[model samples]
Target chain A: MRFSEGTHRLHWATAPLRAFVFLIVYFVLLGFPLLLTQTDDGVRLELSAEVAVRFLLVTVPMTAIAVGSGLWAWLALRFRIDGDDLVVETGLLRKRRRSIPISRVQAIDLVRPLVTRVFALAEVRVELAGGEQSEIALRYLGRRSAQQLRAELLARAAGLPGHTPEAPERHLWRVPFGALLGSLVLRLPVLGAALLFFASLVFLVMYAEGGMLAVAVPVLLGLIRAVIAPMVMYANFTVATSPDGIRLRYGLLETRMQTLPPGRVQAVSIVEPMIWKAIGWARVEVTVAGYAGERQALSSTLLPVAPRHVALHLVSQVFPGTHIDAVPLLPASSKAVSVDRADGAGTDDVVFVSRHGWPCRRTDVIAHARAQSVRLTANPLQRLLGLATVHVDAPPGPVQVAASDRDLGEARAIVESTARRAQAARRAGGDPTHWAAR
Target chain B: MAAPPVYRADQAFAPGNGLRWSPNSKRHTWHRLLAAALWAVPVGAVGEFIVWRNGGGPVAAAMWIVAVVLGVVLAGTVAELDRRSLGYAERAEDLIVMHGVFVKRLIVVPYGRMQFVDVTAGLLERWMGIATVRMHTAAAATDATIPGLPAAEAAHLRDRLAQKGEERSMGL
Candidate 1:
């Protein structure tokens, strides 16, 4: 496991974000005196030399700190694999050299941000066998280099290498652009939370101080930008899978990359988000050994928002020979176990007793829970539509199966049953066919 | 039937286990005992800081050590009880380790679930002639660790786990 590829460092793409942080501090420092000035009445203060010296004194250190920190960060990362040893050389004064054997490099992926896509660059991350992180990262490399590194690692592992991944055929599910927009429009909770925050701020200001009524419109405009930002960031989000693994890249400012080993995938989940209830979109993700390059860092997301039927089809295509459709879902039959009741009713893992059922959009914990991020989610519409979904998420390599039970109880039951069945099968010579639902 | 040394030497893998499971290092009596002892160090360190700040009087320092030790010992008893209650397993097709000082755990790591098994010895562990053996299961939470194991024995255990896991995966 060695890296003999052309070596290069991280690009200067993150400068804008660094500058933005600097500007914020600079203005805050500058704003302190202006706020003091407004309290001084109509007289303008003269530009005194003492103030000039104070400003310079602060500015020099502030600039150096900003520049120095960014430089160190940019310099710390040098991702390479020489022969069999994968290298991660980082740090400023005291250098840290961490290396893993090539065989230890389990999974790898290429991440392209929405912006990086335009420039045609990808950040390649190599995941090691142990630890909770990807371990090494090479930021903003040409697509070819990412491909070549992936190939070399796979080949060294005695697995197939040099197989260029053709991007999955897009629009297989064919989710309409208008449908996406409508779902965005229907996401009232987000809009409501934003409006409520703004209104409260205004009410607080008007009733209390009442002075900043002058900058109201500009503040309102800024508020709108904040509201629409997340939707746009994830709007064009999509995933394209290759035979080797799953590759996902999305986001506006912050780009991300995730790669899963086909063998390490313990389980996968096909998620149907609540907002897309009417349109029926589902996303797929595989649970791997180490998780990183994710928006939800603590947890894993296969594809945050994708069409449902397409997701199922994609899963069958990827894993192969597994039941993909509804195969006698036992959960809907009220056979799943319940853990507790909201109001402390039955001692047995009480089935959620709410006849009106649960809030459609919710998350659930798993049998072998990894992070506290274990959740079962559905949208508001999915709630009203009388379909609740539960997924048992194991942190890294839990079974990647989704059983859409009628209620929370059913989901829990199915998961327990599946786990028991899996354990039984493993004991019985680990026959894959043992898992194929009769 | 008495289970064979859950691990063995000279043999690549063994057959005949009905089930396997992997659980993270589950809390044991030893772990509970260790956690209790850890609390005393912090207490002693802070008390040392206080003694240093004041006049370095042997009597005062000795008195502080007794008080801190007593308090930690009392607290540790309760904490150990709590720690013992929580346990987890990395269940697999072949092997399982039941762990818990508190909420008892049975983590089963079957042969197939053991992805990679390694025996590692750090400076101290090496000097002590002990090593840490890790078994990675397919499931994230399903892993097993047998720590403070003699180094020679740890190597034997790692080889056995890997061989058994691989053999089972290959349907041996």
Candidate 2:
């Protein structure tokens, strides 16, 4: 079927709402001048209501003009799906056109602000595969249409034929309230942050005794809020598998739905924080290209908090046919212990899985074909314990999944074997005809 | 046809012929120099204004000038040395980018995993006729880039990389 050539405008209700937002922003900016004025002596002083009234006469018209232009720009904007690409054209004076191929669409996120939610509308944001600031956002779409558009983009990107059987979506897991609260309380970072906050508060109270309660009360509330925010986000977190990819739905006050497609996931990491160690709870996260921009440091959490078995199960889905804890890692009593670390790193085709944690444990696994790079590192304490760490570098993410504290020689061996296996896998998979073709 | 040769799981594998390292264009030196000058302008202007207003004498002025000159020279030398250290090698299945002088870094991006290749140039780079080619892969650690290539070469490389990426991505 041929796609329509004509441009499609946004929902009609968007223009007035957009204009209202513009007016709010303009008035807020204009208020700066309204509240303060420069005196002849060059000192800025607060203005009275009489002066504010005088300023509003000029400010009101300026705001009206700004809103009028913003409405015009919004009206001029139009988008259409042409062939396999989503095309957007905007700007009344200097026209800007963008066409994003459906295949390049990496992720589509649906966000509903309080205002939009009241109107049963949502903002659809589409992220493309490469480039900084590669996002096409359509604000204020009817909730149902927004969801349909998201599904369509995802379906197209996956190259699924129309009328494919609807795979019954299954809920894989949900974050239990008990576990969510435990995760929040047991998080080492939050504890450390709280400690620092109290430490500074005590120091300030002792150093500056004036109005201590005034400062302490707000800061204390802020710290509590900071900790509670993430807890609330994970309160009812749910993971579901669909035809497109994985569906993540969570958040208490605001609901956000993110669809992550297959193969877009760069790396999967399961982190067991120190406090959560005894309970065997871990958080699973994945880094996807373009999601974190060029820095590539931020990771989107797949499971906010889950049991070790559940977390690993979720991770295995990303790396099909790979088991986390089933493989045999080099034991401390291996014969390779006596050999030089470098020499022990002899080739072996088997998958080297490293499981580590004292208070918390994490088992990271990658198929030889999927392994990126392997390195061995030994800290002072680990060296004293005759142990070394094998860090398997995946794509960009905050979590560095590593085999921590193995016998030095065994760690080296694991690194070497992993590298060799990865190379062999690459050759076998990459070159279909092999050397004969060449 | 004979079977494809198979390596023992233990055998060491080296990706490329240990040769043919291509360095970026020398024009990057001028581009870096211009950037350094532009950066120094604001600092120098602000310092001069503050010193003059505070009734500073000739020694302060001279010292500021020396510092500015030293900064520019240091930046230029580092830029040139860094440019020299940057090199890239493209194999059938992967691209390797080697860089850094004191602490070397070698990044290998598999073609099959490459998402896209971006060719970009800033105003200074455009004026100098050089562009930067960035290769995006599934893993952030393996993302490789070649800066200061001639614009034509950069564009050509971009197309070639994209084609190779597509051909190999099929295995994925």
Candidate 3:
């Protein structure tokens, strides 16, 4: 369990589970078409001895290769803690050695895909503060070992002394299944899809048109993917706070536990879809530095659905002393009322908040110190209107903090003030490297 | 609606804030023109070829010539204006880059937020003795690029920005 002492190998189940995952993909890709083939009489293809031999000939070698490579990869991969760095050695012939400094570790996530979960295995992903390639993934570790390794890495990253156990998590909130399903139903896309389905059904009944099948089938598929998929993924959503950071655990088929360390959240946005307003519900999303490109989707969601007030409480907890309601929100310039709503931007000692978007409203909050840059932009039309937009830039993620269509002078003031506040905050900011030492 | 807030030339953070905006080298205009020509020539030839293949009379040929001329003039005018608009200023805590004629944009990136500074020169730029200095921060949205600086100035600016970035380095 002491990860600092010796090199660690993945769980023995890794190879078999990895091979099983590959075989599933191969079957779906290669076998589906063959199974779906029909004769002139529309009877599905039967597995004759020749077909059986062919299938065996193909799959037998594929099984061997998959299992062989999986075992080989498992044999080649070795990781260990060396002083201040976590070194991972991989590759067989053209060897690769990646040594990541503990101080630079942004996050450590434990992911259990469905197949791996069946074997009580999880993948440990270490995200560093850099580009997309900065992540190191150790696939298929024993579930308990994965958790222990995560705790150890996080403790080391937080500058804790040797052998500190994982911090006790204080359960903050859990989304009820009824609320999760209700929230999904209330979504704009789902509601629209439902309406479309009903409309098409009526059309089909009244007109008896075969053409409607084309449209209905795709809509049903989209409904399954967009609505049902998230419903399953966000089931049993729970959030807990600890010294390691905010811990999020959720998923139905494939569970994941993600830790967002202190000072790592670059920006936060509380989103309230129009329909959800009736139920007083909102979703919280955040932007972290390293969760970019493909990983941005599921990882950025802090809370899938929560009551409006609970969401506010979670945001406050994430930012410690900052309270959304306490900040005096200034109205957008009178000139901007026609284009943008009166709700604009506000800033206090710690964070800057900007309210924008419509129907699906978003309130973006960013710590003054976390702002990477400040931008002021105006198109020819905006210039004529004497209005500009101020963008408080953060890392690439869903959270975008911008006050659009503000009076030019006010926009200029925002840019100057935000930059000044950011500079001062950085000067006063605590040392992030030694988070626990502080 | 309210007669638009009085537009001021010297707003605090405006591109025209009376800060000494260091413009790109004038040679950049010629470089841009050459780059434009590299594309225009082939496109013009294709257009002429199509006209000839279609057996269009001298009138069509004349119109094509006029169109090509207008395009070149437009490109030249844009290049000159863009060159004029491209400028940067070194503020106390941040570096400001401003460009664009139609949609003027000014971005202020604090030195502490800069992850790295890159100086790059394309073949055309190298031939024209110019390079570009780009500053990257943790945020990919930070678009801080000052192009068409004299090669030496670009190198000097890169070194200076890198040093400032180091001195103010705060990890994300």
Candidate achieving higher TM-score, 1 or 2: 2
Cα lDDT for residue B89, candidate 2: 75
DockQ of candidate 2, scored on C-alphas against the true complex (2 decimals):
0.12
> What is the TM-score of chain A, computed separately for every candidate?
0.57, 0.74, 0.92
Give the DockQ (C-alpha) for candidate 1.
Answer: 0.08
lDDT tens readout by residue for model 3, A132-219: 7988889979999999999889889889864899999999999999999888889888889988987887888889997887878888
Sorting all predicted structures by TM-score, with the top scorer first, yields 3, 2, 1
DockQ of each: 0.08, 0.12, 0.48
User: Interface RMSD (Å) of model 1?
Assistant: 16.6
Which consecutive 10 residues in model 2 chain A have the weakest lDDT in total?
A: A339-348
Candidate 3, residues B97-147: lDDT per residue as tens digits? 888899988899999999999999999999999998999988888999988
Model 1: chain B TM-score relative to the native chain B: 0.56
How high a TM-score does candidate 1 get?
Answer: 0.53
Task: For model 2, name the residue pairs that clash.
Answer: A277-A359, A395-B140, A396-B140
The candidate with the higher DockQ, 1 or 2, is 2
Q: What is the number of backbone collisions in each predicted candidate, taken in the order shown?
A: 61, 3, 0
Name the fnat for model 3.
0.66
